[model samples]
Target: MSHYKSNLRDLEFNLFEVFGADRAFGQAPFDGIDAETARDVLAEVNRLAREDLAASYTEADRNPPRFDPVTNTADLPEAFKKSYAAFMASEFWRLDLPESLGGTLAPRALWWAIAEQILGSNAPVWMYSSGPSFAHVVQVEGTEEQKRWARLF
Candidate 1:
């Protein structure tokens, strides 16, 4: 059984009530996404975190990754790989990215809220999936040449 538990109500309260994420949505940059859509996104991510992502949390902890000194690499457990693949396939990570990178313009609050669900379920999933966020940073702050390289991520 998974040990992870998500407090989606609390998250929604903070985002919609306290932070006024609804006001931010359907506005500049977040034009396409509205309050309803944000709520749906949160619900979906919460479900995913509780089910797919949390499925392998304990197994991964028990098995861990096997490091190869000679090859300088590690082999992740199959269970963890499946969970990682599920998260990648969800494409929710694209919410915070720019439209140029095939992502919608989401508020930072929304992105962090999404992050909390994933992180609370399985930390390694969030940690391993930092490539897109890192790429976004590079695309924004890097020179033209470096920006091109960031797209590969």
Candidate 2:
């Protein structure tokens, strides 16, 4: 069994009921995703978090990443790498990115809702897989040349 436990019900309540994220979907920049799609995304991510991602939590904690002074790099545990790869394969990280970057223009509320699950499941996985979001920042704030470079990330 996995060590991480998520309250998906409470998350949905906050996102749909209190925050009204459903109202934001299917509108304006978020037209690509509707309420039903958003819910599906949440459900899928929840399963991934509880099953695949959470599978590595205890193993990773027991065998943390190793830093090599000579190589100037840190080598993550194999289990952690597997979990991170699973998340990247899901491609949900693209939700908040711009259309030009092959991402859906999702609402911040929905993004945070998704983030909560990933972070809660395995924070290291979320941290290591932040390249897409960083690329998004560079795409938005960087110069034209920099924007081109950000696409490679």
lDDT of 2 at 10: 95
List, residue by residue over 11-73, the lDDT tens digit for candidate 2.
Answer: 899988987879989998789999999999999999999998999999999988788999999
lDDT (0 to 1) per candidate: 0.93, 0.90
Pairs in steric clash, model 1? none
What's each prediction's TM-score? 0.95, 0.94
lDDT of 1 by residue, 7-41 (tens): 99999999988978799999987898999999999
Top of the candidates by lDDT = 1
